[model samples]
Target: MSCLKLNNLACGYPQHGTKNSELLVVNQLNLTLNDGEIACLLGPSGCGKTTVLRAIAGFHGLNAGEIWLSDHKLADVNSAVPPERRRIGMVFQDYALFPHLSVKDNVTFGLHKLSKSEQNSICHEMLSLVKLEHLGDRFPHELSGGQQQRVALARALAAKPSLLLLDEPFSNLDVDLRRTLALEVRNILKQQNITAIMVTHDQEEAFAFADVIGVMNDGKLHQWDTPYNLYHQPNSRFVASFIGQGVFLSGRINKQHIETELGHVACDVSSSVSENIVSENTETHVDVLVRPDDIIHDQNSTVTGEVCGKIFAGTSTLYTLKLPSGTELLANFPSHLDYSLGQEIPLSANFQHLISYAKETA
Candidate 1:
């Protein structure tokens, strides 16, 4: 059985108090998590990611559908098992460790069901799992932000809950610390074979931590897929624009390729599952998603554009190119090859296939 299953899940708060109309935050969303799998819900703020997390944790009652954990039906409109009784653990954004409690005590809080010796053993194991065995005596306030986050994780895992939920657990840390702690936490969770679902707006963290990612927008799941597929084959243009940086050049679907002002390019047009512009009439408008890496600096190619802007990255520099049509495109060039603004440079497409979508209108 799957560790967690959500079916046709719909939830919303009453507009004020009356039920005449509910402001729906989660709508007809279905998700399934297998045993020991780590999934992440990624989206911008106010996209119903947190609403789904709260619903799964039993904080908000569902307006429709059901939530199941393995064989147990934890929630439905008729009833909701209290969050405490669901054997589900949560690591809050603030690292909600009790101020007065020592790390050992904090880790032991949820292990009350076990014997004293058993609780101590589990707490010690959890501490070791989080690499905090040396700081068990310290209180939450005594530890650094990273340490405090580790303690919160240890406490959550101490009880060995059936599932773990992390709600932006690294949001409070700095950028470097966020990535370090996120990778460390992923290691710890995997070592324990814990099934977890994390909510985050940070793409880097989600990519580093999750085995599967569900990209959501406006309460709807756009795609539930691997990180690779989400990057390489985004289900919607929203995902393409949101997940990474790219420029879409307007073009038309031709006989066997896409005709554009830059040049004629050939790729799998069938990849555009949403847009079928390749009928008997090949004059359909489409936009090609040209990622920075897809473009390369080539002196031999006839195609060229003026350098609009540049950013110095350690290993490579990002160059912004403006086409003759005044469309902006980006390409990453070697840091050693410096190019100045307003200088026209030759370029070529480096990718084997191109991604396109039906052109958006003003």
Candidate 2:
């Protein structure tokens, strides 16, 4: 059975001059999260990623549709459950720790409902889960940012909630720590088989932590797919532009190949559109999505591109290559092979399967 399900849920703030006239932050959103699956809602600011999380947490009532947690309908009509009673755990961006409470108390606060012995045992196990068993006696103010966040996580998990909602939970930490904890938190969640939905605008975080990702734009979900599918077979141009690093090069398609200013580019989607163009006698325009790794630098290759810019990125070097036709492409090379700016380098595309959207023909 699905762990959490949202059917055509519409949630938003109210605006003046109209009865329920406020623009919907999340419009007719529909999705089902399987048990133990971690999904993420990814988008820019005001795109309703957090709004969706709040709605699922029962903090906000849905304007339409139904939500089910563990096969139980969650709606206003059915004696709406309060946040605490919903068995849903939340980890906010700021960690939202109570300054007055010590780490032990903060983690044990929710355990007050249980017997003293059970609560003590649960708290100890929770502390150990986050690897901060020794720091349980310390206050939130005394611990490092990462430790504080882990306490917050442990507190949420201690409740043994049916579902967990994390709203940009790693945004407060530094880059390196954020990456490390995101994976760590994912492992912990999986170890507990906790159904979780995390909200974030960071693609790397979403991809790293989530089993599936729902890419949102404006107030609608563009696509809810695995990270690999969302990255390689993006349903729309918006997702292609948003998910990964790349520059779109316009191309025209014939029977089995795309003819662009760069050259005749081969693709995996060639067969899908191959026969359709034979009878049309029209060129199908497309945007070739090329990531940095797709372009290989070779001294003897036939393709020549000028190095317009370079950024030393430790293990790898990112170079912005400009083709003779003024088309710009990014290529990443090992740090050992440093190519100066303005130097012409032979470039070859190693993209085995390219995703391209048809222009003027769709």
Candidate 3:
């Protein structure tokens, strides 16, 4: 079942110096989240991802389109249900906890309509759900960043909302903590079967937390897909560049294969080539997306490149190799097989998904 839906959603802000004019941020955006599934709006800062989140949470009104939660029509251009009535929970970037209130008090804040015994019961359950049962009496300041975030999550889930919105819920934490807490929160959401949508500029966080990810740029959603597909089978050039680190290797379509600097590797050239390029034309130029993992350090291979740079990442080393044609490529190899810079190392192309775009003429 569909838990939330955004139909032709358009939102924006007022024009700076013009009357009767608006700046459209999100235009004709459409997405759907199934019951208990988590989604993410991932993009750079000022990409209007947060605006979409605010619109769904009732903080912003739609210029056009409807917001639906299951069978309920929550908002449209003509009218909107208030934020409180939308049964939507929000976990802000700062983990907006009340410093004056204890963990129990904060979790029970929305339970005022229930009896005192009921509020306490729900608070206990929520705290236990977030693994903070022993910190109920502690204030927000008494807890660590991760603990406070967990409390915020507990507070959001305590209301039993139909949908939850998280806006960079782990941004304030350190890199390691951000990843750890993201996974922890994902497990908690899954354990409770809570449907959620999070907005974050960090792709790693999105990959860790969301079942579906929508990559946005310039107020437009470029692609909505799984982390694996977004990385492997990007729908657009922007998605291909934005999702992961890679270098575009100049190649030519050769029947069922793509001829590149590395080597001629057979691929489904017809489907992978850009629409403007005719796959039947063997001379048609194209730029193939080559990720670090696509390049293998094969000592026996005839093709080779000079090691220009290397970053040792404990278990693995990312080597920057410069091909004779001056095309730079990144290759990931085990740290133990370290090679000094300027060494000519044998390399091979391991094309998993041959993604290519038409070459632009200067």
Candidate 4:
């Protein structure tokens, strides 16, 4: 069952120094989340991902369209439910816990309507769920950053919200800690069957935490898909560039294959070329998307590139190679097989799936 749905939702803010003028931050956006599913809105800064989150949380009003939580209507062009009235919870980036309050008190803050006994019971349950049962009596200042975040999550979940909104909740933590906490929060949400939508600029975090990811650009949703599909099968040039590390290589589409500087590679039946351009009588010029994993470092291959740059990444080394035509490509090679700058290295393409776009003219 779909737990949340946004239909043609448009949102914006007032333009500075202008009267009755608005600047749209989210335009004609549509998305859906299944029951207990976790989704993330991902994009670069100032891409309106946060605006969409605010809109869904009833912080911003819509210019058009509707917001629905199951069968209940939350907002539309003419009407909106107040934020407090909506059964939605928010987890902020700063872990907005009261410094004076103990962890147990923070989690129980939203259960004011319940009896004292109920609040304490729910608080204990939430603290246990977040694995912070031992720290219930400690104040926010006494806990580590990760522990504080867990407390914020516990507080949000204590209300038993129909939907949870996380606004870059892990951004303030260190990289390693962010990843670890993201996994922990994901587990907690999954165990409790919570439907959530998080807004973030980090693709790695999105990939790790979300069951589905929506990539936004310029107030528009470029793609909404699974992490694997977003990486292996992007829907647009921007999505292809934004989701992962890759470079576009010039190529010519010839029936079921694309001929590139690397070689003549067979296109998967699901490739855009096979689906959209195969019927054309003339060969089509295109820019083929090549990921680092698609490039195999081979010693006995005729194709070779000049190693221009390399970054050692513990288990693997990322090499930036310049072809004879001056086109730069990235290849991930094992750390043990060290290659120096200006060294000529043999390479071959081993694409699991092919993706290409029409050649863009200058």
The regions of model 4 sitting more than 4 angstroms off are 268-270, 274-279
RMSD of 4: 1.6
Clashing pairs in 4: none
Give all TM-scores, in the order shown: 0.96, 0.94, 0.97, 0.96
Best by lDDT: 3
- What TM-score does candidate 1 get on C-alpha atoms? 0.96
Please identify which of the two predictions, 1 or 3, would achieve the higher lDDT against the true structure. Answer: 3
**Whole-model lDDT, candidate 2?**
0.86
Q: What Cα-based lDDT does every candidate model obtain?
A: 0.89, 0.86, 0.92, 0.91
Per-candidate clash tally: 0, 0, 0, 0
Model 2 / residue 215 / CA error / Å: 0.9
Error in Å for residue 13 of model 2: 1.1
Write down the lDDT that model 4 would get.
0.91
Query: Which 10 consecutive residues of model 4 have the lowest summed lDDT?
Result: 269-278
- Clash list (residue pairs), candidate 3: none
Give the candidate number with the greatest TM-score.
3
Task: Write model 4 residue lDDT over 1-362, tens digit each, in one string.
Answer: 99999999888889999999899988989999999999999998988999888988999989988999977999999999999988999999899899889888999998999999999999999999988999999999999899999999999999999999999999999999999988989998999999999999998999999999999999999999999999988888899888889999999877778889998898753455522444457878888889999999877788899999999999999999999899999999999989999999999899887888888789
* Clash number for candidate 4: 0
- Candidate 1 residues lying further than 4 Å off, grouped into runs, are 17-19
lDDT of 2 by residue, 209-282 (tens): 99999999988899999999898778788888898899887777776777765567775445423223334466
Error of 4 at 48 (Å): 1.0
Ten contiguous residues with the weakest lDDT in model 3: 274-283
